[model samples]
Target: MCSHYDPVLNAQKLKQHFGVDDLPPGLKPSLWPTYVGPFLRKHEHADVGDEAVPFKELMVGSFGLIPHWAKDTKIARQTYNARSETVHEKPAFRDSWRLNRHCIIPAEAIFEPDWRSGKGVATRIVRTDGKPMGIAGIWTGWKNPANGEILRSFSMLTVNADDHSFMRNFHKPDDEKRMVVILHEDEYDGWLNSTAEDARHYLRQYPADGMRVAVHD
Candidate 1:
C-alpha cells in the first residue's frame, strides 16, 4: 500500500496535465497519513450547464480517508490506502466506494521500501516520462461533531502486484506485493464519472514499464 508520496506542487504541470486550474492552498510538500493534499474530482456542474466549465475541480483534503461515521480524524492513519479486493466491505472505505466518490490523487512520486539489499531501503517511483501520476482514489466528507466543521479526505486504491515485473521488487519478500492504481491521461474523465461497479475496471495495476524507480541514499 502507498503510505507516502510527493504531491504534485507545480502549478503549470497541474494545470496542463490534470486540467485543474486554481491550485488549493496548504498542500504539503510531501504527504503521509493525515497530511493535507490536492485531489481532482468531477466538477459538480460538469454536466449541468456551460460547456466552458472544466470537467474537473481540485480540492484540498487529508491524504487518508475519513468516513462519515468516523469518530475523529485519527482514523486517517489506518485508512490511507484501501485494498482493491475488499474496499467495498471495509468499514473505513465502503461508504465512499459504494457512493462512487471517485477521485484522482496527483502525485509527483511514490515511495516504497525495497528489502532486496539485506535491509529495508526507501525507494522512489515515478513515471519514466517525468509527468505527474494521476492515482485512482475515493474521497469523502466527515462532519466534526465537536466543532461542526466539515473535513474532507481521500484514500488511494491499491491492487495486488505480486506478478508485476517492477512493483513486485519492493516490500518484504514474505509480504504480498501491492501497488496503487494509476490512470492514463485519457481515462480521467471516464473514471471520475464511472459507477461503483464500473469503477472496478480502473482498479487494475499500472504497467511496470511505464514507471522508473530510484533508491534513496
Candidate 2:
C-alpha cells in the first residue's frame, strides 16, 4: 500500500505543469492517510453547474477513498489502495471506475518498506531524474446522509511488482510486491478522460531504471 507520499511542488509550479489557470492551496508537502492533497480531475457537468464542462481542475481532497455506500469514513484506512487488476470490480472502487471518475495524483516520492535487512526498514522512492510522478487514481464523492455533507476522496491504483527489478524490493517478504501506476507526462490527460476499458492500457509498470531509492532507519 502507498501509505505515504510527498507532493513537493508549490501552487505556481503545479499550475504550470498541469496546464491549468487555477490551483488549489492545500497541496500538502507530505501526505498520509486522511491527509488532504492536491489532485487533478475533470469536473462533472452536474457537479459544477454553469461552469466550463469537461475542464480539468486541481482540488485538495483526502487521500483515502470513501465509497458512496460507506456508513462512515473508517473504510478509508483500507481503501487508500485499490489493486489495478480488480479495481473495476472491487466494491469500493467499481462505481468510480465505471463512472470514469479518474484522477491524477501528483507526488514527488512514495514511502515503502525495504525488507532486505531481515527486518522492515522505511524507504523513500523517487525518480532518478527528480521529476514528480503523476500516479493514476480513482476518486468518489460520498454524501453523509446524516448531515448532507459531501466527502471527496481518492485511492491510488497499484499493479503487481513481484518481478520488477526495483519495486520488488519494497513491502513485506511474505506479501505480494506491488507498485503504484505512475503515468507518463503525456498520459495524464488521457487517463483522466479515458473510458474504463481504454484506461486499462495505461496500467503497466514503470521502468525500474528511472527510479532510485533511499533507505531510512
Candidate 3:
C-alpha cells in the first residue's frame, strides 16, 4: 500500500551510493503518467568513480505493470503494484520478476495510511532516519508507433505488513498488507542477476527489523 513517496536523494545521493551520476534530462518524462510536472529536477551524477547507466530519464516514479500486449494504458492505473509473494507466479509479473529484476528505485520515503471514512486518504509516511529509501522494482521498455520512440516504465513490490505499527491500523483489510520490498545493499547483485527462485530468496529479507518509520509531513 505504498501510495506516495518523496525522493530525498538528489543527484549526489545516487552517486554516493551506487556510483552512477549523469541523470536523465529533466527526468520529468519518467514521473507517473497522467500526473502533473515532476517531484524533482533531473541531473546526471554518480560517485566520483563508479560508472552507471545514463538514460534520457532516471526516475521511474510510477508503479505498475504495462502488459506487453496492452491495448490501452489504463490497465496500469489499476496495476501500479504487484505483491512480492506471488509476483513470480502471477501472469503479469512472472516474466519480469524472473528475468528483469532491477533496483535503483530512489525515494525519500513512501506514504501509507488508514481512512475510517471508507475513502483512501494517504497520510504521507517516511523513515525517521530521514534518508531516502529504495524500493525494489522491475522495469520494461515500450515503443510508441506514433513517435517511433522507446519508453521504459516500472513497478514497485509490496509485502504483507508484519511490524510496521504505524501502518497496522490502516492496513488493507484483505491482506493487512503494509510492508514494501526494500532491497538491501548486500543483495542488490543477487536481485539484479536472480532467476525466479533467486529473486524470491533475496526479496524475502526485506521485512527484517531495523528500518525506521513515521508519519510524513
**Each model's backbone clash number:** 0, 0, 14
Question: Which candidate number has the best lDDT?
Answer: 1
lDDT tens string, model 1, 128-215?
8888999999999999999999989999999999999999999998999999999999999999999999998999988888998854
Flag regions of model 3 displaced more than 4 Å.
28-62, 116-121, 162-166, 172-175, 205-217
Q: Between the candidate structures 2 and 3, which one is better when assessed by lDDT? A: 2
Candidate 1 at residue 130, lDDT?
A: 83
Model 1 ranges with Cα > 4 A deviation: 215-217
TM-score rank order? 1, 2, 3
Q: How much lDDT does each candidate structure score?
A: 0.92, 0.85, 0.55
Positional deviation of 93 in candidate 1, in angstroms? 1.1
Clashing pairs in 1: none
Candidate 2 deviant stretches above 4 angstroms: 45-54, 214-217
Of 1 and 2, the candidate ranking higher by TM-score: 1
Ranking by lDDT: 1, 2, 3
In model 3, the worst 10-residue window by lDDT is 34-43
